[model samples]
Target: MLHVRAVCPAEHTAEVVELLREHPGAAHLVLHRGAAVSPEGDLVEADVAREAADEIVDGLCGLGLDRTGGITLEALDTAVSDAADAAEEAAPGEAADAVVWQELLGRTGEESRVNATFLGFLAIACLLAAVGVLTDSPVTVVGAMVVGPEFGPLAAIAVGLVLHRGDLVRRAGLALLVGFPVAMAVTLAGVLAGSAAGIFDPGTIDGNHDVDFVYQVGPASFVVALLAGAAGMLAMTSAKSAALVGVFISVTTVPAAGYVVVAAVAGRWDRAGFSLLQLVVNLAGIVLAAAIVLIVRWRRQRSAPLLRPLSRG
Candidate 1:
């Protein structure tokens, strides 16, 4: 369930109430008339079932409430009300299956921005992976993957493509286009420094170990990337984020990019080429899988509002 807080203009308060009254999924509805000071208006609140949130938000937007005032949704850690249980039961679909598009777009918009923090995390993750590649340490590579922030924008790109939002697609593209190259450059410098200090042995990397997986662009890589992408999409949409760490470790994106850097710095052109191939394959698989997941999740539901019509006296 989601707790929705809305500030509706005076003119739209009645419409807002009528709309909520029509939705069985809206429970514990509260209205405070003329209570808001900033952009002064009425304050309306409700606990809405996840299955019905998309429709309720759509109705509110259709009434122009978003422009006039604003609405915000917060997930409940626990809702112990009988009313909440009843609302969920009355909603047409299972809560777990629902996809709140507005919420997702809003989330991806914030994450897709190309900023210093985003780049910093990417650079650090890549540098860590460079160390992992040169030393042939699977543990270090997994750590880099966990620290990498690339998946957020990657998921944003998929969301943009699914929703046909050009701006989001461009934003996500910019982040990726700039971030990966910058991370690779930093990793290259790090590898050079490590080599000069005798911390990284190129011979270790040249041999077969867990690090070899970072450059092996085979059928297994593609299959794992697809599975990771779908799992990532599910983690992003659901309330629980524990699945995200598993998603992170399951893909070879950061490690592959890191291998490209280390191999290029070591003047191993063949290894660099294969590492780049691995990077491309993983990214392509992830994006395609995420886009497919979003399409199927959003397009499946077709039904009337979960709220039954009010009786005509």
Candidate 2:
């Protein structure tokens, strides 16, 4: 549910109330008339909770009340009043706002700034993973997993496909293309610096044939990427972010990228190829998974009707 706070002219209170009364999903309508120091000094304020916030806003806009004042909607954790529900039950109009293509596209743009940070984090994560690989410590590797930030671009890509926004598609693609190479280059520089300090020995990386965890890349990795991508998308779109942490751990982009850096420093061409393959596979999986999610969301929106009239006796 969402909490909506609207400030309108005092004269428009009856129209706003009538509109709220018509919405079946809105509850807890509180009207503050002759409010002092409001949006305008003489504006009235209405506080309400509605199941379909987007729809309610749309209806209110349609009634020309927006010209008189502004409305703000915020999501609330608590329940609202029964009278609000009764009002929605009695109202007539659309059930919800039809999915707005431009809005989804705009969201993708907003997501890019977040992706830039994720990319920088990915570089740092690879450094951590390299440390873990050097020490053969699972705990450090897990830390790297938690720190990696590739999920943001992955989620953005998914949202782009769902919304069919070309702008989003372009932005997401740009982030991925620029982010990975920059991260890889930074990791490579870190490896060179570590070697000069004698903290990292390219010799150890070259000699460690037993470290199967760092050397091999295969179809299994690609499959994991695909699954992780889907899970990441679901986590972002749904209200369940807490679960995405596990998905980050399950994928190998950060770990593998770290290994690639180590291999480059050690001159282990074979291992570098393998690690690069892992990165490619993981990225592909994420993109494909996101595309699938968008398709589903688009289809669902297409199938739903816009408005249904209420019976008037």
Pairs of residues clashing in candidate 2:
21-87, 22-91, 23-88, 24-88, 24-89, 26-84, 27-84, 162-294
249 Cα displacement, candidate 2 (Å):
0.9
Candidate 2 vs. truth: CA RMSD?
7.0
* Candidate 1 segments exceeding 4 Å error: 302-313
Candidate 1 per-residue lDDT, tens place, 9-111, comes to: 9999999998988799999999999898887999999999998888998788777777778888888879999999999999887887788777888888888
Clashes, model 2 = 8
Query: What's the residue-level lDDT of 71 in candidate 2?
Result: 57
lDDT of 2 by residue, 6-93 (tens): 6766666687777766556666666776673545623323334332554666666655445556655554555456665554454443
After TM-score superposition, the amount by which residue 31's alpha carbon in candidate 1 deviates from its true location, in angstroms, is: 1.6
TM-score of the candidate numbered 2?
Answer: 0.73
lDDT per model vs. reference: 0.86, 0.65
**Residue 172 displacement (Å), model 2:** 2.0
